[model samples]
Target: MREVVLVVLQLARMTVTDLLGSLNLPEEHIQYWLNRNEALHNFCSQNETCYSKYELNNKQCWGYEASCSKKDSFSARKAKCTKPNSWQKQIFKKQADFAKLAEVLSTITPICVSNYSEGSSLECSSHLRFCRAKNIFFDFHNLNAKNSKRYRNDVIQKGQAGGNCNMLFNEAALRSRADEKSYLQSWAHELEHFSSYPTFEVSKRQCDVIFEKPTVLIKLDAASSMYHHFCDFVNLYASQHVNGSVDMDIDILWWDTVSFLAAASPKPLIIHYARNCERASEPSALATVIANKNCG
Candidate 1:
């Protein structure tokens, strides 16, 4: 039975590889897929029970959800080690392998970028004030003194005071600081160590259910002054689509973000900036355009 399954997987891989080749993907992509597929086939054959537990739909293997978590119980971790070919490994490898390809695929003409009503700087200011209010006694001066030299320098260079927005503060330090002032200062000190900006948050909305083909919806907030940060976030998000599907809808709330830049400069000037940004061989020109015109 296992022999038959192995043979079938071999044929399927060959067929899929040929189909992928027809799509004109890079040779490296095809080779990488072939190698990974072979590993998958071998694992399935060697451990039929575990392979049987995984979900398969439309020729895509969606590995078990329970195996995806790193914080799983000891028993779950033991199972993962015993099995060795868990879905979490597959997800990480797939994401890493296709990240660069996803970026290039995003630039394809099939992508539709549209702007909605302008975002409000007032709302952004409100958010910033709220953040400040919540940590009312957060002394940047005190925190700066306590932080490491590297962290202090980074905070000075980039206006980023907090570490990555998604990460949690140190539990030990957070617990140790008895007073609110000390606690908040410790929090600020940790935040400077990481560079994370929340200029825009990307969410996929109804693309899977509404579109016939695979479509991605990227929502960018216009209220953000972080145009350069938005580009970085977009590039990171784009790298996740390993399948090379290019049909994308980018919905931008344009007021404070895109329109703010547009309002300051003439159409001809913006166009010149865009041309200079495109023609420049290095990132310096792009950086200049982004800083001066805020349109890159």
Candidate 2:
């Protein structure tokens, strides 16, 4: 189905949101589709096989250190990457737990993306997740590492990288540039990686488990400052609307083809006009989502 293709694109590291921007899809139409779509759930269940890290020995093993600088540079370079039997055994033991993780997310779909998330600075998101048509960007900033670090580190000095917000979803356990998550400090902030292509869909049952309060939000301009403006906007909206919660999911897009999915779906989707701000500033003006939506 259309969702399946989107998942393939994500697995391939493409950005669906960017792809859509290139097409003639209306932003609201895309949002409407996202508000009522099933592809995200399918992709999550289908692509579960790729969620885990690939042990170094699976393809061709290498003893590259943390920096991936070859220490020996001899057979180390040629070492085949293989599945760690011990790790596999552990996974089997933890199958129940892992299944639980998926079960929780099995019903949720990412309707759209917002690339506007710059912490207190008022900058827009480098990228955002969108539903087929829904504009799910109001809180996109909360889901952004770039925005969080840019703001949090400035205050807490946690040493996390600024603007590096894709959640590090590489399945092969490749050395990632992302730092650890504030919640899962021991583990790299890899959970956010699922946000790129989107890993789960909130089913009715899951919805009961997790409550999502939706609202309108602006995607921040990566380097631009809009913090004060956003706060003011939130207050302004809250005065008129009771549904204002100022929460949105922020994530990265691993693939580029993700931008094209709009051609198949009838629903309107919300996505960055180009790549997420995580990668670039919004085009001087809304150019073409297709031409400018490059991940590289």
- Per-residue lDDT for 1-296 in model 2, tens only? 11110111111111222223332434322322222222422332344332231111222211111222233222332334464345654344234111212221232232223343321011111121111122111112123333333212121122211222233322222123123333211112312332222322223321112112221222222224465334333222221111111112222221211121222223333342222222212101110111112221
Question: Candidate 1's residue-wise lDDT over 1-296, tens digit each?
Answer: 11100000000011222232232334333322322344434443455553464332222211212222333221223333334566865444344322223223332221011122111010001101001101100012222222223213122122322211232233233223212211112222222222323341111220111111111111223334687545534432332223212112211111010112321112212211111101111100000101111111
Residue 219 in model 1: lDDT: 20
Model 1, global lDDT:
0.22
Candidate 1 ranges with C-alpha deviation above 4 Å: 1-18, 21-24, 35-209, 219-296
TM-score of 2: 0.18
Of candidate 2, the 10-residue stretch with the lowest lDDT total is 3-12
Question: What's the TM-score of every candidate structure?
Answer: 0.19, 0.18
Model 2 segments beyond 4 Å from truth? 1-171, 174-201, 208-219, 222-296
